[model samples]
Target: MENHALKSWPDVAPKLVAVAAGRAPADTVLKGGAWVNVHTREVLENHDIAIAEGRFAYCGPDASHCIGPDTQVIDCAGQYMIPGLCDAHMHIESGMLTPAEFARAVAPHGTTSMFTDPHEIANVMGLEGVRLMHDEALLQPINIFTQMPSCAPSAPGLETTGFEITPDDVAEAMTWPGIIGLGEMMNFPGVVNADPKMLAEIAATQRAGKAVGGHYASPDLGPAFHAYAAGGPADDHEGTCEADAIARTRQGMRHMMRLGSAWYDVETQITAVTEKGLDPRNFILCTDDCHSGTLVNDGHMNRVVRHAIECGCDPLIALQMATINTATHFGLERELGSISPGRRADVILTSDLGTLPIHRVIARGVTVAIEGEMKVDCPHLDWPAHARDTVHMGRALSGADFEIAAPAGANHVTANVIGVVENQAPTKALKAELKVQDGLVPGDPEQDVCQIALVERHQATGGVVNAFVSGFGYTGQMAMASTVAHDSHHMIVVGTSHADMALAANRLQEVGGGVTIWKDGKELALVELPIAGLMSDAPATEVAAKADKMVQAMEACGCTLNNAYMQHSLLALVVIPELRISDLGLVDVRTFELTPLFDEGQDQ
Candidate 1:
């Protein structure tokens, strides 16, 4: 396979010098544009850029001398020539599409580079799965740097995964050409407490001279947060508030504010820069998770930049946050982030900075997209058959399997419930009084309380851990089951009716793995993510269309939360607070312990 990584400066310097000195003709030249200089934070007007061997050779007020008779010259028409946008942290599998398809979807949005963590797949298929994603990422026309998954189970003992990522895996991944750093170290407690395993993984990445991603999900800004920062993570994207962003940057870690499909964190966190006057260089922009529908209908990093601008941030500063700041965080500023002479020729043409409309996108000196349409073909990986057949339910489920038996003669109970917070990752731990019916506790749709179960699919244990969840606003007899449960990759079923929940769970098992919605014992919508139950090899547009239908189906079921599907997927993520469910049991994330569903004495 051809190494798609940009050639080193040493290897391309001679050619670049020849082109700049007019000793050789440039391959392409973008003339008469306004260069958005990220390094100095200024827009130099009437500039021209000359490219040679997929790297910029000359970027100045004029590059007429570098142009030759055979050089391809494109007039920018005074458009704002900004560095191609980069997502500091994201997951390709979150889009429900493989790396190639995700690239195809986002390239049109002027996202030329992405630093993706394939931990979602790693939880299901282990090191081999990560390799598959990394290999495919290297084949894309744009830059897709893979991060070695640092936490597969995410929280040890709090959850169980199909495969666990070890320190050896981190060491091995560091040698891969496409690996940029270690994926988000989700185990904040492990780092803070100096757990040998977490420290060893961080050591491996640091020894290899790569960035270590961070995920300090706790809201506490106490000693624990400081200890986590001292654990050697260079950047973090889990900050949700201004204080979180300030603390992260103050500790010399880049605070990556995200604006994904459901994560609306940029507006709140960017205040560290907009209001507090913190240096903008320490703040980056990213999309921690975006579904296929969002990629197709909305934008990628472009959307994040626009959102930051809309949140009372300067256009130049927002552009820097999405571009140079991100590249600098990952140690690729010289190679890909800027429009400098030695950097990869990744540039985007926009008429306005605030209301950015990507008219043209150039990556590695190639016009990959034009007018919100892809101009280049993104190559795909030939996935093996085993990757598609991952769901193992042991046997079909039934209504009885979902029944939550009441404790002896208990008529009512104060149940611990998982509350869904819209446009955020963290959930709320709530308590509700529920009544028993026929020796079983039943969901009350009128109170907006429903049954949530974690069906263990990885080991085919047939173990169903039942709990309660509110805030979805789901009514009637409906259930939604997804194999894309975060961290554990187990099947999560939520519904008011046990029969519909059974139907939904069984449907996903029958189709290998994906998301399925059932209402009144009939299937409503399905998005078949057959690849490790986390992603599909289908085109982004097709997957997005199905995902759109799935969202509509959620709405039809009376779910009023924004991006309820995202909320559903994260129900099993034990890393984030304040409550969650896993294959093990109901998790009180604030305490990082498994708690019983019912409060003591409430079952009387």
Candidate 2:
């Protein structure tokens, strides 16, 4: 892997001083551009930037003195030389592509720096999986920093993962190259409650002088929320409302507003700066989870910045949220994230700020992308066979595996349902009364109720926890199954028909691991994610094309929720409220405890 660590400034200090004094020729001089000075939060016109050894040596009114016979000068007429964007918090696995491919997909959108949490892969393959993601990230041409996963099972006792991440794992990862900090501490309750293991992980990262990421999914802003902020998480991205943002910033935590494939959080949280006039420096922008289709079509950090501006934020302020604010939060302000002297020459030449268009992208003094296309290669890692073959079903699933037997002598029962909220992470805890047929509880499409099953893929326990779910508006005889279930990475199958559900679950096992949709007892669409069943080694466009088909297939089945697949993938995430499914049973995330499937009720 390439070493992306910064060179000692002292080693290049003499050369940089000489360039600034016009005594030495700079390697590249970008002239006649308006420099977006993130430090001063202003745009200076007709500025020139001199670069040497892939670092900016000068950014001022003119670089004529720094230019020599061998100097390469690029004209940036009518362009805003903005610092390259950064995503402060994200997961590379969420893109359903390897780090190389995810970088390829987002580079055209001017994302020069990324802080990725590989916890999703960590849940499946443990520390080795994190190393694979870290190694691959180093091979990319941009600043892709890794955050050692802190929570794999995310919430212990509430869920079970293929592999568990220990405190020793977090401490060991802190010593690896390119590791920025600890990943999101999703067990906010654990931190607030002062769990020894959670605090140890946070202490390890802090002792190493690295940022400790936060994930406070609960809405409680009482003593517990305050305790969590006091527990050492430097920044948080799980804020969903304006109050949440205010509470975070007020407590000295960076409020990271996100706009991902389905997480519509920025519009609500950005009001902290735009409406309530909070300090913009304490706010940041990020995409917590973005699928391939969103990366290929909608945009990445660029999309989030645009949405922030639309929410009444100043264009410069939004850029700071995406760039300098993120860099400063990670203690990387001097290394990257701004068009300043001694910083990496990662910049984007754009014509507008609000409707940002990536006309040219420069990373490490090299033009890596131009006009919505990549101009360089993103190197790949040779994934081991174990990473490709992760799906393990002890036995083939049958229609009977999905059957939910009704309680004896009961004709109707109120079942706890995992309600899918549109474009949000939190689901509604719902109860639906259903009539029992043939000693079984059949899914009621008329009530928007369907069956959801968590098929244990790890250890091949052959444990299938059956429950009910509402929403998705699924009408036809269809079923959807994915091995990418959150936290545990189990196989989650949901449908109205047991037979089709069986077909979908078995098909993913056949493909090693991937998502499959079955209708009328036939496979309608499939995306083969043979790599850890969470991501595909295929090109982003290929994976995105298949994902597009999956979305269309969901729509064809009479489901009209935005990014339904994302909601489906997160159904097993036991950390997020209010309800979820796991190998144990239906979990009321609000209580962080397993609950009975059927509520107490009398038979009709």
Off by over 4 Å in 2: 2-8
**Segments in model 1 whose C-alpha atoms lie over 4 Å from true places:** none
Q: Please give the lDDT score at residue 390 for candidate 2.
A: 89
Tell me how candidate 1 scores on lDDT: 0.92
Best by lDDT: 1
TM-score per prediction, in order, is 0.99, 0.99
Candidate 2, residues 323-386: lDDT per residue as tens digits? 9999999998988989988888899999999999999999988888999999999989999998
Report the poorest 10 consecutive residues by lDDT, candidate 2. 1-10
TM-score quality measure for candidate 2: 0.99
**Per-residue lDDT over 308-388 for candidate 1, one digit per residue giving the tens place of the 0 to 100 score:** 999999999999998998888888888888999989999999999889999999999999999988998898889999999
